[model samples]
Target: MPAPLIWLGAACLGLYASNKANVAYLKHHDIVDAMPGESDQKSIPVNGSIVTCGIYGVLDHTGIWYENTIYELSGKGLVRCVSPERFLGNRSGTHIYVACKPNNKVLANCLAANRARKQLFTLLDYHLFDQNCHRFVAEMLVNHEVAVTSFSDLNTFLSEFFDVPIKWNRALVKK
Candidate 1:
């Protein structure tokens, strides 16, 4: 076989194996898979729900849902409230996903929302691996400082907070 073909095949196999491992992990933890491309009905986010949107189809940007608005930390480090359109703007996907229970009911924490509201317009030293959106959202949910580098970490925190399996509900909250 050609060298290029062999390399491509190896990469494909590695991706498949990685996906399988991730699926098994989620299932063992009672967590739902909510990666982009999954079919989900559009709904509105409830206050205090942890919401996320895909970025470049490879990453997810997280925020807190409150009063029909999303509180997110911009890359520039400013925490601000944004409409759903703004949240999804210039992103790879159009739908926003919220944390939910197995019954599809949205899970929320008012204290988290309050924390996010209080932190509005606050500036932080945004570090992609540390004080980024995932960490910000996780801290709001937990009402304490935490280290969350990705959606999986945030979901783990939320699952423990609500004591329920976390699923993602696709929502499109409008102004």
Candidate 2:
């Protein structure tokens, strides 16, 4: 009947709904539609100097994908490929890119939150944890697939992903 207990209860209820919605969303439009299968979305090829795959629309399918390639199309229709990682963060000039698979959708909200925080850490350039700290997040983000939006939502993701904190430095990752 204490204040903390009431707050905790409300928080739990909210999380339950958030989790449910996230799962429902992943199913509704198929966040992992990029994976090859019967539920696959669609891929279009850009006719340039070479063959390249493009996911149409403002595809919210964001996650920790590898540094595949970055392409630039000139008015002349000339296409060039580079590294998506080093050049991504696109409009912001520093947005981290991610990719998720069928299972990557598992990170729908949990890991998405963590990776975003990890990014915020880097953006602020704080060495609060070890240099290798980001690697743990990177591992989770690249966990076969993930879709984090920014570098400021880590704490929320931590609660969303794991019910407990098993790491030492993890506490520092929180606000």
Candidate 3:
């Protein structure tokens, strides 16, 4: 066999091996799997009735959902409000894990305040390790006296500090 052909075969094998390893790592870390037609909408509370606060992502990305809108500080240095259909849609490969659903009045007030403080709410301030999307969500929830620590600390914080039930929903990945 030609040397170049042998090297090409080896490279293909290496790529396949690395891909499998990546999938295993993601699963070990509890990253939600992407199945066909999966969706997060089922877990979302009825609009204007309950505020479902939670994070949605696999391993590489994550965002927050409040009421009907999903908010996240994108890597582009902006806080974006994505529609539920876009956020949890099959195109994004994101999932929803409801940490807590607070009272309707409380959620309404939070949403109102979130709208009123537009400057603070949609600021283009993004820090990956210190002040990322998770931090933004945690701050907003904490300000409303709803306990949440950070993106990675979600389940533990919600379980220990709040009485609201937690729910999970997996969104589909676009093929």
Candidate 4:
């Protein structure tokens, strides 16, 4: 066997090991898994709750739930509010998950909703991995600059902000 082939096999094994370790770390931190299609029954979200919906079963789009609508950052960087149906439209999944406590109690801060509402029609420089929906939601909650890039990152921030482990509850779309 060629020496280069042996080195390539070693590198592949190392990569696999690194991936497994990363997964273990994320699970240990209690990062909320925002993957969609996990629930069938619809649920009502509390105002100011952090909501998320799956995008193509791989990414999660986040927003702040206020009143009967969801305040989200559009792909074009416009901050707007929309109905739950509109939120799920054109998405790969139909369920929107709300952030809650481990005991299934909805976790929310009214101030977050107020902040989001105040920012309506605001335009931002949206970046897919940097200045995206997650950062927008985080900012709405904290009213400060928060660098959140992924669902798990936002969940971790929420856990610390609320001082508890965060859980995802499927939100109900009222007719």
Candidate 5:
């Protein structure tokens, strides 16, 4: 084995360890699930604003549930309303976060209009780092003044910076 190979192996192991630690932290905090359906779905208010955030595998996906429809950007590069069950079935160990705020009629209308517009449902130029599911959710929420602009900032807001209420299933530990 060459010296370079040893370094590469070490780097890979480090990355793996870091990911494991992050996952563990999330689990311990009761923010993520270890398996599918491990967490229960939180109820969305009928007259308030809500954003449903999900983590599917390594991908963090999010959507807004409005009028009983879940709007999200599909892998096919289109924004569409999908059934909650279908969305959850896409991946195991999915974690959902909901943020609810008062008087979000404007945001609700915007989402409804976007869903109705065929033009907005076109191909999405998905970029993993620059433009992804998280970005999409952030954009929608920010436009409605429900969330901060930056995704990193929003994470902080979700965890600490905001007075808005959030709901999620309790983390379950397997025996």
Candidate 6:
């Protein structure tokens, strides 16, 4: 092999190994400047663009503004920073299937039980906020299309479950 080509292959391998390790760290952490309520709101700013570019493309949602080049959200609920080279690999199109093993089963049950209310709620009925099932189950979704009317109820719900003032929620309404 040519000297230059051999060095290129070694470089690619090094980058790939580095990215795989860093992704695990970025996915589970909130960046330094992130607001407190970002997790509950489902809004996260990711520095990794390698993963996010394809995520938006898959969801058909765009106009995403960010400072870094590789900021993208993966289907697994992992918002990550992607490298320019790895950006296209993340573009498999379906994000609904994440790490949850029973996600499909739970979602299916919910759709069957409540014809009116769509997604998540049905699955959450059987799931709880335990160590095993803490990630996806929402205590309340409050969608206008299906009409979940409760500012008071929502506040009560969070307090009872989380025991913290979802105090940052106030910031969302200010503007």
- Give the local distance difference test score of model 1: 0.80
lDDT of 2 by residue, 40-158 (tens): 32222111111112122111112232223333322222223334443333333223222222333222334434443344323222232221222234334345333333122222233
Q: How close is candidate 1 to the true structure, as a TM-score?
A: 0.83
Task: Tell me the whole-model lDDT of each prediction, alpha carbons only.
Answer: 0.80, 0.30, 0.42, 0.80, 0.47, 0.26
In order of appearance, the predictions have TM-scores of: 0.83, 0.26, 0.46, 0.81, 0.52, 0.22
In terms of lDDT, the poorest run of 10 residues in model 3 is 100-109
lDDT of 3 at 28: 56
RMSD of each: 4.2, 18.3, 9.1, 6.1, 7.9, 19.2
Q: Model 5, range 104-157, lDDT digits (tens) per residue?
A: 211233543353333246677766555555555655644433434233334434
Candidate 3 at residue 23, lDDT?
47
lDDT of 1 by residue, 2-51 (tens): 99999977976785666557656775878654443453745567788888
Better structure of 1 and 3 per lDDT: 1
Worst 10 residues of 1 by lDDT: 33-42
Candidate 1: pairs in clash: none
Superposed model 2: Cα runs more than 4 Å off:
33-175
Cα-lDDT of candidate 6: 0.26
* 4 versus 6: better TM-score goes to: 4
**Number of residue pairs clashing in candidate 3, backbone atoms closer than 3 angstroms, sequence gap of 3 or more or interchain:** 0
Please provide the root mean square deviation of candidate 6 (C-alpha atoms, Å): 19.2
Output the worst ten-in-a-row residue range by lDDT, candidate 4. Answer: 33-42
